[model samples]
Target chain A: MHSESSPLGEFDLIQRFFKAGADAMRSNDQKMIALGIGDDCALLKPAAGEEIAITSDMLVAGRHFFMNANPELLGRKALAVNLSDLAAMGAKPIGFTLSIALPKVDAAWLEAFSKGLFAIANQYSCPLIGGDTTAGPLTISITAFGSIPSGKAIRRSGAKVGDDIWASGIVGDARLALAALRHEMNLPESDLKQIEHRMHNPTPRVELGMKIREVASAALDISDGLLGDLQHILNQSQVSAEVFLDRLPKSETLQKQSEDIQNQFAASGGDDYEICFTAPIDKRDAIDQISTALNLPLTRIGSVTKTAGVLEKLSLLNKNGVLLDETKSAALLKSFDHFVK
Target chain B: MHSESSPLGEFDLIQRFFKAGADAMRSNDQKMIALGIGDDCALLKPAAGEEIAITSDMLVAGRHFFMNANPELLGRKALAVNLSDLAAMGAKPIGFTLSIALPKVDAAWLEAFSKGLFAIANQYSCPLIGGDTTAGPLTISITAFGSIPSGKAIRRSGAKVGDDIWASGIVGDARLALAALRHEMNLPESDLKQIEHRMHNPTPRVELGMKIREVASAALDISDGLLGDLQHILNQSQVSAEVFLDRLPKSETLQKQSEDIQNQFAASGGDDYEICFTAPIDKRDAIDQISTALNLPLTRIGSVTKTAGVLEKLSLLNKNGVLLDETKSAALLKSFDHFVK
Candidate 1:
């Protein structure tokens, strides 16, 4: 039934691109997955006491990523971005579905893409449960599932006043990568590689998020730049934040860029795939312990204030130990909204 | 951002063609749906004690359906087809994700499509949780999730010899509809309307499937015609069957068509969306009671047999008390592989 002249149809594309990445037989512990992939519908056993976390995201060609970008990285990033949401909620990754529309079924591209997706799924212990394939412009939409205990599931609206704000990993590197991809700036090959890696292969921080769920009051994944993402938490938590620009974890490569570029990257860059969370000051010691044990960077960049505005300039101090144009810094953050819309 | 001169951009197209259909606010039952549509990633809470059934299917223009067809029905059918997989497993509908790709965002098409999707979703009580939208050839991919009790999933491999074979509703209507749509046949307005309805709004039979889960030893939904779908059950169950051609349901319109056209339609016609199941003879009484209660047609077309060969004909005595060619009469049911390729 397979034919080269046929141009690799949807069924073959599914077998080559999607079926390989799915790990439906990891552990026999899941009696609910009676029938997994390679079937019309998967059979799952809904165990008592666990709530399912479902999330989906679509990555479009050009709009979401460059068409010339590596297919494997694109696939990995597609799944990774969705996994970040599960991480924010402190849920354990279980399985996910991929719906892909492609211009044509290229075997080499499919091989690499599936490898990238499976790499992350294997690392996170999630299986490729079920999905659909079709023909169109290259687009990948992934719907991921996770399991969490009832009532313990974290929400974005749980932050309280007087809470300490924390962010995982450095931000802005991804934005710098995007700039580099657009050829707006030229940098050393090593630096370019670093920035590209940051943009393409973001770690979802699943472990750190799961650990923090017990103590963190509220959490959300950073996707649409730190400023915008943090604003969501603040809005949901009904509190204000004082973010320290000086405390912002900027990559060395970003710092080496022009000062204006660095500021823009720091303020408005998206695709960080990090976790921004809030917890009461009382849990500071536990937070530190978690950071130390996981050996992952956790930076305390600000505090949740009782006021109703998200102010970042208040935390930036000039080299002379005097506050610089705080209003200017705030303006930079506010300008990100334009790019997002 | 809404520009007709430049054509609808990908983002605007997404907002119109995809996001407008999202009815995320209707259901609060799934606590795990922390973040519904309109976000980078949707947050969900998996309920305790139920495992998730995840599946995805993609439909492409000029491949799955005609582009000139009603967008609303296309949108609804895209989702309904996926939901049918869940029903086959006795899973309860929960939520779904829609990833749509279009050449351009036409506001009118989007409105109609969204109305179609939300209308069906409301009837089935499934919420549009999250998905991605992009620019490309017209294609829709839906990843749907449902919950089923652990270890209670019905599968295709559970049928035993001597089991009674049953089919729900009428078959060949969809194929007949397709033929009419393609102008293969001419019929009265009433028949044309019925055929078009069958073609456009193929119901998934979720309720009947759920009800049959208790008594059905094995089951499958007929998407790829009756014979091909039933073959799957036989292949999985490692059993064969004798089918009575006289018992096969046929609409008056189908009967009016030439015998060859009727046979081909019955054999290779796709989009039946009916349930074909096998059960022990002891459960026949209970099955009839359930069928009567549901006010649905339940045809006892045949019985499972230890013999292992395809029987297109059954030697039942006719009114003249002579043997007839049941195989020739039943030749309309063929494997889906013949037509899809």
Candidate 2:
């Protein structure tokens, strides 16, 4: 993990970590990139009818990630995070440019890192097109491109009141991993492995995202805490939501944690890289079909309401089968409070 | 120009130096760029009938430019340098992404720097698409994108041995500016002003490059000095050139410098940002027309020869009709050599 002491110079680092990773992933049926990775520029031919989607993000040392994180995982996460942006917009991944600044080059670190990057890029069919490398503190900035049909992009502002709120896959595991990294709590090695995987290797739901475009009214990826991220949709769509605490999809590892910690992690912890989208209630059956076809879980956690406030609380019933006010129960999970900071 | 002491915080620095500049540029009509500079990612529509051209370059502090050079000029130069790469391949400027690592944010510096960036971007019609900002040592990396009609790009490998060599505008001013900055030579204020402008703001020959695509066999912009950069084209094309020192275009300011200094400046100083290209003899007349229409001076310095060496001097008869071995002419410039240790 101490890559700074490795023997690879910058040029070798580039040859090892960057050059091969991009070279092995050419899109099928798409006109292969004319020039990629090692040249002054990359050349790409557009498909006959589609448009390109481009996005960029910067990760700085000691700012974006922990200083001692595995370089291989870091490279993969960088590409994965950017890909999530494209997924959120319903675009198909195409190619990307990387701008890396390093204090010094380490050969072993670069080889592993580039291998990791290439592994994911190859899986997703995104080619490494062009980029720049320079000497400085560790910083990686990537601009990823994708393609989509014209006028079909799903934006954050499309959700409407009464739309059913849905999220794909599990949540809160990444946050738990971060806590584990900090050594705040002891957990079994098996659970630790799962949490670490969730933290370092997020799988952007690209297929589900593309399919959701046909059924969801609005969409965005959850990079920040779920509450804060969903708030973006609420603010943009002018709606509020009341998520049912009982309906949230939690990982088995998360369920094994204390209930209060799991609740806080679900509401406040970020980096899930999962799609949080909304659709009309009538499309629930269609969503179920999509979920089944993708073999991925999709949960209807709540409904968007015309009201302005977001509420989360446990439900209770008296012996007479009458619903009871659970004002204090809201404080138990602290769902709304988790995202305040 | 020590921007580290300026009052601006990081966020304001980004808004002033980056955002303001982006706001002034015109959008590319050929592609669908849904979200450009303001968002986390730029949403672009792939050009339906074109191929994308991408290039990137990094300018680092204490390596690329003077430590105290104006930050505004530095910002603009970052983008301009990358644009020069696109120009080398005859690509139409589209958009660019910037990854800037700064030691500290300085408001006034950012304002001037961003204004410089916007000025060039507006002139070239390339918009600021997307990028990232980080806190680190001063470094700027720009990844620029452009497009060309499919299979229409000009490349360095296309030059033939019998082609004529041509360069646009004048050279040597940028190198002279560097000398002046170092206080190695004393010149009049007017002369200093002219040379400094060349150093601070380089004009990438975009229009000239696009025009040359029709007539030139191969092309590249002059950044790493005319001799070294032209060698790239020669090496790639596997041709040798015999450039006539007398026919080289020089600025009045350069002509006023001491002969020894002028030779060194012209031979080794980089950052000219002029287009150096090769064309078959048959296209000379048509290229002259293009030069005239564009109001740009095209100097025919020499021709590509069957020989494999870069001969800076050619034996030729002087103005008095006396033959001289130009190889021994003290007027011939010697290349500058700088070693990094």
Candidate 3:
């Protein structure tokens, strides 16, 4: 896939691929991006009484995806995952910076990659601003910027005791796709087609996140799996959680799996890019209306509680109110840690 | 260098190295960073009438540095290069995000790396507000944020004809150090010691950039050689330049090199985090005062000109006012493009 032409200088490559992508996808974020690519630094001018929300994420070849993964989907997923972080905080998409290390320049690959990147960027009104390009093993690092009204960002530390834990959309399909890809499981053609997009093009819940700011006391995107990601809110807010294991939201395709597989995958499916949030019990009706309005499932799966114990920041319980044993719970899910297996 | 106690998960690794670095180096940028680590997104709150400047740069192992390079200095240079981008825009550093991928967790290496990162971060009051850590071949990506008063940033497109071009500090020591390291040439131990630090630890002229904003019509930091980087200003401002090769700044150590070597390195040395700027001839005295107040050498090296031709963006001449032959000028420098040698 390497190009046969003369080596592309960094500037020419950037202008040919990324700059063209950004220019085609130029959004209404002019107030946020005062100056873009072509300068030493991009200028971000926020409106009065607003603050910028920033997050960074990195994806490495072979680790995050197969070395042969589609460049278009890879580029789309790279930016989508970062945007989901902003969605978790109820922030409006503003702009992003990309720093990529490539094995070599490939013209066709870059063309498809830029197409995917700009398609999603334009959809979310998030513009590309500034970045660095270098030569190395393949890696893509994106730092996404979003804006929120002053003092209005929903934070992971805001969950309180007695809050209801809610999750947006389905969670397990992406994990299932991974299993199939790894050859640990086999899926019928129809099933793979039904669910593979969850592993490829995740839909960042930007509008839902912005709309839920008043409802969710605390929130985070479930990129690392539901139970593990929810632990972040519990640990940050200094609260404990009791989750009803059977209540996890799952797609129709995921429901066709065995009971054990469904529960485990639904609980710990990394790359779901769904929102796991906590809110006061009083906001249940409002949340339901929001879910309906957005045509997305907002499932109530658990509740915040006083400390269960120091070793246990969160707990999984059967619908019968019996706590799952440590062995079963441990086997079911833990957040996906990049450094760990 | 691997740690045996346990595998450091993403969050733990981040908390152990980067968060600790940031906490120790916490600066008064609390006004800019409203929220820091342990959140879905870090919040940046720019004060009244101020805008944010953002830039990202990535450094990869084996490509940007040796596999066995000093961890501490590597960490320092990574952030230094990015902060220099802000300095080019005449912005005050506020905060930054780091996304790192490592082959394995080395506790000692990370400790030293974090120490070096925080040492300079604290010096500049540029706190680390957020970051992501993962496992892969070593790569470090940083997106730094700075604050500039609205409409006050020095941009690359602002250079005017007859504008005097200036460069901050000496330029070729880092390149000389690189040559020594590569064994392309040899230096005495004392000379090597004097020049090596220029490569290991570049000082981003932050305060000088802020001070020169009013005087410099256009500005950029010299990370990628002076002549090549200046081409960016000329390209943006639709101007050309005539540089006096003998007037290019060099240290006493660099002056010991052959005249041809000195001229080549000074004109096109990469990784020198000095600022190159342009201002109307009338502002020379003001720029001189800024240089004196900062106790940094500000050298007048060239002047902006109308385009000589489409292909020739900049021309270099000797003291006799004769333009250097195309072969010599071509031999001297082209911006160091990462994709090329």
Highest TM-score model number? 3
Residue-level lDDT tens digits of model 1 in A221-287 = 8876776677767666767767766677788889997776776677558788898888999998999
Find the candidate with the highest lDDT and give its number: 3
lDDT tens per residue, model 3, A1-341: 01222367777899999998777666464667888887999999999999999999999999999999998998899999999999999999998999999888888988888788887888888989989999999999999999999999999999998999999989999999999889889888899899999999899999899999998899999998899888888778888889998899988898999988999899987899999999999999999999999999999999999874562368899879899998788766577777766
The sequence of per-residue lDDT tens digits that candidate 2 reaches over residues B1-341 is 11222344444455676776676553445244666764335665556667788887777777677778887788678889888889888898888877777666556666776777777777777878777776766777777888777777888878887799998988889988877777877778888887787888887888887888889998888876776567667666877677765566789899987765665566547788888899999999999998899898999876787653443223333334454464533233222222111
Pull out the clashing pairs in model 2. Answer: A51-B46, A52-B45, A52-B46, B32-B45, B72-B113
Q: Name the DockQ score for candidate 3.
A: 0.63
Candidate 3 or 2, higher TM-score: 3
Flag the better candidate by DockQ, 1 or 2: 1
Candidate 1 chain A lDDT trough over 10 residues, lowest sum: A332-341
Cα distance off (Å), candidate 2, residue A287: 2.5
> Lowest-lDDT window of 10 residues in candidate 3 chain A?
A1-10
Taking all chains together, the TM-score of candidate 3 against the true structure is 0.97
Cα lDDT tens digits, model 2, A187-306, are: 888889977888989997889878987888888887766655776677667676666655667898999988677766876578898888999999999999999999999998777877
